[model samples]
Each structure stands twice: as C-alpha cells, then as structure tokens.
Target: MAQNSYRRPAALLAYEVSWEDLDGAETEVSPPKLVEQVDVPATDQLELMNALWDAVTFDAPWVPETSEPLRLVGHEGAKSTHYELVLVGPSVAGGSSPIMTDPRFAGEHDAWDDIALDKSVDLFLDQILVPLVEVYGLGNMAQLDAARLSKMRERVRLIYDKHLMGLGVYLKAGPTGYVQGMKFVLQEMVENSAYRLDMANMIRDALGESAQNKVSIDALEARLTARASATAILAVVQAVLVGTDVGKVMYDLSASWPEVAWSAVSAPALFALSPSEGVVTRDESSVKFTVLPKGATSGNYRYRWTTTGDYGLLSDLLLPDAKVLDTREREVWYFHNSPANIQDTDRDNVSVEVFEVPEGATSIPAGAKPIARMAALVRGDTRVIDPRLEVNSGATPADMYDSGETYPCVEMLLRFPRDPKAYGYVVSIVGMGGVGDPRNPNYHFRTGNGNVDYRMDNKIGVNVSDYRGTCAWYNGFFGGDPADWPATEPDEIMGSGGYDASNETMLLMLFSAVDYDDDEDLGAEADLWKEWARGATFEVFPLYPEDAR
Candidate 1:
C-alpha cells in the first residue's frame, strides 16, 4: 500500500499571436507572434501542477466545467484562424469589460495557454519578448536589468491585455462555468506574493476625477460590478498569465460575487480526475479505482489492508471487499504495493487473479453469488464525520452550502454488480428518502438525483452538525453500522437508483465522511472500493425468494 500522488498535465502547447491579429486590427508587426510550444517539466512546478491537475480531474472543489444554455453564436471559424489565438471571456469585443464578457465564441486554438503558474512569467520574458528584440532590430541585450525589466514589463503588459482585451465581442452568457479556467490560475497564484492585487491603484482608477471627493458608499457600490471592475479583474488575469504578482482579480471579483458576470466560482465536490459517469474498472492484480481522502490531512500515506473480496480466510466474507476496520499506530497490516486494482469476484468462481475459488465448485462458495454493486455518477465530499456527540460539535447547525460540505471527507468509487447469471438483485434506497437529505434536505435534492443513509440507525444521538464546522453526509452506507447495519443486509445500503441496463454496471461511489473525534474506522473508505465489484457477492441466504426461509 503506497501513497497515491496527484499527476500533473503531461505537456503545454503555447500559441502566440501577432500584435495585429490579437487586437483584431491591422498592424505592421510581423513575427509579432509565433507559437513557441514547450513541454512543461513536471518537476519544475510540482505543487502548482498537482493542484491544476486536481482541478481538471474534478478532484479539487473550485475548478468545474459548465454546459451553458445551448445556442450557436454565429460562426467562430472566421474569427479564429490557425495562426491566431484569443484570450476569451464573457464580452470579447463588446463595450465595457470585453475581457469579462463571454467565452462561447472562442474556437479551440483561440485561448492563450496561461496554464503555466509562475513559469508563465518566464515564458513571457524568455520566449515571447526576448525573440522580439533581435527580430525588431532593437538593440540586443546581454542580461536583464532594472530599467530593461521595467521596459519589457510595460511592453508586454499592453500585449497581454489586448490578448483578452475585448474578446467579449460575442459574449453569449450562461449561469455557471462562466469563469471556466480562472479558478486553476487563482488556486496556484493565491498564496504566492507574486500574484497580488493592487487595491490602491484600482481605487484610484475607479474614482477618476471624483477621487478628491470623500468616498461615498454610492461610488464604491457603483464600481463594484461595473465595467471598471471587470477591467480590474481581467487585468489581474492578464498579469498572472505573464507571471505578475497576485493582482486585484480575485479580491475585486469576490466583492461582487453571485454576480461576477461570468463563471462558477466553485465546482461540486468530486475526485480530481474522476470520470463523470462514476465508471470504474477493477480486475485481480491491479485495481485502478480513485479515492479522495476528503478530511484526511494532506500527506503521502499508504493504504494497507486485505480485502475480503481477495478470496481470503478473513472475516467479513459476505462483503465483496471490506477493509478490516483498522487504523495506523496500533498493530496494522501490510504496507506492501502501490494502490492498484481490486480483485474481481466474478472470476473467483472460475480463474482469478488475487483470490482463488475452491476446486470442484463451478461457482463461488456457499451463501455468496458475487458482491452486489451499483453504478452512480456521484460527486461532492463530506466534512468531519464526527464519531462523537460533543456538545459543541452540534452547536453549529450545518454549513450545507453547495460543495463546501465535501471538504475533509473520504471519496470512494466502486462498481455495482449487474449479472443475473451470478446473482440477481436491484439497488434501492433506505433511510433518508427524497423528503430531503438529513444534512441538506430540500426540494432540489431530488431534482435529478437520489441517495439513502441505509446504516444511519444511530441518528438519535448524532447532531446534525458534528464537532467540526460541517456535518457528516449520511447519504451512504460504506461507513454504515456494523452492529445495527449487519453484514447480512447489503440490500439495506443499496441505492434507490436501479442498475442501468443499456450500459454495463456503473460505479457506486461512497464519500464516507471521517471524524476528528476518532480514527478507529478511518481506513474504511479505502477498504470498501478496493474489494467491491462483483454483481452479487453479499446476499441473504435465501437470495432467490423461497430458496431459504
């Protein structure tokens, strides 16, 4: 059991545009832009790259992709050519803040690859502007100095702004996913002193001639979401795309949030790089399931334990895969190999990889068909799953905001079995029905989804909001009860959503929230997905109606 590290984007393809082409007007500057692409070395920006990768994979909370109100915005082929690249946003060339307009019209090659965190600044200095010096007949310089640096900064500042200057030219808007890629850049730039906002400058620019007058609430309020505001935010994005210090983009944008003109400030909680359908694959030797230890501290830790699904002489055999309810520090099991695929229970009856079926038996051992599984397109994380009922823990109701509750929880992605040959069963709901989720029950809860806290029988003493700022998500049973939720009742934890027939079995993702109060059942999430995948492993002795009493 080795630590699961985050993977960075394998490469970067940079595209530069001429000053004329970028601005949408004619200019004499030739060789003004050349696509000087380079592969970003993973080691260069380990932290930044991992974070960005997390965002794209949906493992991170903020960076999410949105589908807008489906409508065509004329033809984009005429605007973006192979040689040209545009910095897209809400209102491209429209009035006011073109940079913040809309991004619907942007073609594939139109975006500037500002994906480089601090490395972007280097790209600007070394590749973008440096090449221009020799080509423009400008005097060649040996090294960069204070004066030269300032000049270069100023020179490219305009170029960068114009890159996204007025792309809002065809701003067709949407409800969310508006600020599509800004969050990744923000996540990387936030802590660094380099990417800071200049509030004083923004104030000066906004007040204009009225700067001398005592600042009035009206003035501040007006500028909050006005064109100038968008300008300031986009300016920061431009600067950061070039490696400038944290600019006023995020700060300015926050003041006017829920109305930032475009883009979702946050995305639903999901495993970074997780698939949208919750589809997963697990054979015997190597399992490729992905889990996000929601509340666990950030670190490189190993997942060590045997899964009952591995065909072992262990307890909890009824479970397709159940990690021995264990923890670290005290006597623990194996810290052996890198986290890989789960052992396939289906094959156990015939030929298996990690686990073996007994001889003379055409199918699995008695009282077992295969592990029951369900498909799900589950997302979001839960915070602290307080194992204790501390008076203060329940003091705070619950911060069931959009995706914030997913913080500090565990993410498990598993498959629900659907094979009539091995075991026939349907996954259904229990506990908190659609009336509402115990944590954040609302009419919108079932707008397009359903979940049940099957093993949530101990609801009497548990507070809605645990000791932590958030409440435990009782939407699943991976962290189900052992005494109350006996191993026999896999059906008790089955989801209400039936197995999808058109496609193969889908994944059953369980984000079992962890508790700051205890660590005994800490390793549950890892253990669950590692073992479960067979269609009907867990079953009632009389699985087939009158087969047993």
Candidate 2:
C-alpha cells in the first residue's frame, strides 16, 4: 500500500526547522525562537532522518526567555503592576504563555471577549493552577482515581470564586478590560486550542512529572468550556499574580487548605463534527459538485450570517461544473438603461440566453424582452470575451447608446438556482451559544465554537467577501437591502460614513444540479479559471444555534 510519496528520498539534502518566540532582545535575531535547530549530517535513508527528526522534535530542549518578570508595559495603574503568577517555565511550543508581556489592540472585527475569556480560563488551569497544585500536593491525590477528585473540586470551586470576587481585577484590569490588552496573543491561543492539552503536559513537566509525581484534572466539566478545574484556578490566580516567589505561594496556599487528600482531574471530550454514514454524489446543473451530510450531534447546528442583510455571495454561475466552489467575485452581467460602450466595440447585442434566475427572485423581472446577449467585466480594449463569462452559443455584447454614457440597469440578476439550500449554497459556518431562557422572546446568541469564525472576506476587489475588517470596499453582489443602498451609483458608503459589521462582504455563485447522462450518479464540472485551486477537499462546517454552544 505504500506509494511513491512514502518512498525514501534518493538525495542527501539538508533540512531546516523554525519557531517564533518573543525573546527579550534589542531586536529579534537569528534562531529567533526560544529553541534552536539540531544539526545532523545529511542522509539518503528516510528512517535515519526521521529518527533524528523525532529526537530533535517533541522532547527537544529550548533556550530560556531573555526577560524575567513580565511587566505592565502599557495601561499603567498609577505604578507598574508586576503580575503575580508567572507560569513561564518550560516551553511547549518554544515559549510559555505569559501574562506580563506586551500590549494588544483588537482588530476592527475581533470579538475581544470571545478571544480573552476562553484563553484566560484555559491558561489559568492548565498552565498556572495545575502546576501549583501538583507541586504543593493539594490535588485529589490519585492519578488513577476519579471519585475523590470530584469531591475535592467543590472546595476548589469556592476558592476560585472567592478570589475572583475579591481581587475585582484580572491581570491588573477588570477581567474584560485586562484581556482586551492581550487580544492578539489571545487570538493566537484560540487558533491553537489543540495546544490546551499540550499546555497541561507542559505544566505537569514544569511541576516535575517524574517517578515521584503525576498530574490529572480535578473536574473536567464539559471539554474546554467552563472547566471546574479551570474555574477553581481562577479563584487562586491572584496568588500567582502577586507572589514574588511562586514556590512559596504554592507552599503557603496548600498549607492553609484543610483538604486531606489529592486527586486527579478528569479529561473532557471535545464536541466536534464527524462524518455521517451516507454516500454523496454530484448534483446535476451546468456544473459539478458533491454534497453529503457532515454528521452533527443531536443538538443545535445552524450557521448563518451574523451581520444583518449580509447573505453569502458567489461570483460566477456559468460553468457547467466546478471542481472547486469559487467564491472569488467577478461580474456576471452589467447593462445600462441608457447604454454606453462598456466594451471596445466588437459586438452590440447583450446575450442572455443562459442566464438562470430563481422563479420568485426580484433581482430580475419575471418576464421581459429576452436578449440574445451576455456581458462580462472586461479590461483594456479587448473585444475578446473570456469563456468564463457564461454566454449562450449565439450570445454577444450590446453596443453603447449614442449618448456615450452607460446608464444603470434597473434590474440585475445574480445567477441563482431555484433552490439555494437544496444545492447547498451557504458558505461559512460558525457554532453559536445562547444566552437567557430560550422560550423568552429577548433571548440572545453568542459565538461559542472556540474556533475563529471562518469568513470569506480575505482578498480585496474579488467576488467573495472581504472580512479582514479593513473597511475596504468592492463592487460585487452587495448583500445589503436595496432600499438601504444609496440613491447614487455603486460607491463605498459615499453618503454614509459606514455600516455595521464593516468587516465583511460576500458574493456567492449558486449553481444548481444540472441533468447528467449517468442516471445512477450525479456529476458537474467548471473551468475554475487561473488554475489557482490546489485540489484540496473543501469542507464547510455546520453551524449551531447560540443556545447549544
């Protein structure tokens, strides 16, 4: 079963590895990460190279940070609030998660609360509290025992709550404000949630996970969210934040605690999507695509637009089949009520023989004088129509009206299939959590997937959404209500300073199933022009309701 890719390389080529760490230096320098690469003579044998790779990998050592005692660099509280709990010890991924370094600014679209709370709790438990407890001998005491840990967790809960209430500040700021300053770092941590367990192990090792020591969670709670152990850690975080000597603080807190036993915390299983036991085949439209149910737990799973008036957008619908669903925006058609030359004079009749509009969609009138014409957004003086432009066999472009100015077309149709949902046109997916009673009319929603909301807004001036939150604008299928659009022509908020959720814009091309020759199987194909696709299997996650987390 081993293929050519698995075969040993024939050459003796050198290999390099890298990492990024914030070291206290005048400036970042060579081998900049806390860890340095291991050097070995080149070898033609794969096994030998892999062995060297393993040795230098997971168990490798790292350089210590250049600075000690992270400080409140900005956001001064009359004087420097040197953070108490310093969890900087062993590097899991080249550096320890630190509370006392640097300041951050949230991105225009970043949900700072979402970023900070999740990270703070995770780090508080795995990186900070767990280690202190293990070193002090205050846990449930048995790595293999579960019931005892559960009982001790009650006291731990009270401990965390009491301190959180007493300190009234988190990391020198109110819990919310303090974390806003760490937005960038916090976002990185959220992106690497898989690092949570690794961080726990790092904490365990830092506390001496040797023949004499073992560590486990006290109450795992539901995986990642509201961990009782983590919550408990919050109560004692103040000790770490303020302690001039962490070892002494650990010793003192354990001595004050009356618990007679030590217990390990349980690990919680993460809630993740899985593949369903079903088959997927292509849908027959002019294009080819396949859809199968990605299994979801029997709970809330619904992903929709977070911003009002912002439905997803697709750029093109002309291809008979598409190997990849193209979100890059391109104009399918543009016509002027008072016509002017949009093209450099080759054809004068706009083609519309293949334009598909939904039966009830208002973008295009139900009945109008049909044109044997099509249009494309073209460049330069070229009369050549790029075949990506969906034009019928006899279709051609229309000439400019004698007025020499192209007036607006009152009706513009985005090529949408009859049933968008049936064909699965929704783009991004986000897991949501609900607040308050679900039966109440005023119930609210929260994003709780612990993953960054996958958005289509990346590239500028393209068919897909631009979500970098940079306030850049493009002329694609604008998802806002037509009534809300300015009375003037398409412009970037010409009369309006801005709109809400300035972070995103999307254009989705919905291609319905085209009939195929194969009755037992469905298939479609489209020339995703430019050969930009790398043949990666595209996956869209199912969204969950806010109440379901």
Q: Pick the TM-score winner.
A: 1
Cα-lDDT of candidate 1: 0.26
Q: Total clashes, candidate 2?
A: 62
Worst 10 residues of 2 by lDDT: 272-281
Cα deviation of 439, candidate 1, in Å:
14
Tens-digit lDDT track of model 2 for 430-493: 2222223231111111223312223232222223422211222233355464333222222222
Model 1 per-residue lDDT tens digits across residues 295-403: 3224322222233332321122232334342112111121112124222111110111111234434333444422111111211222122111111111111233332
* Off by more than 4 A, model 2: 1-118, 137-155, 166-274, 277-549
lDDT scores in order: 0.26, 0.23
Best by lDDT: 1
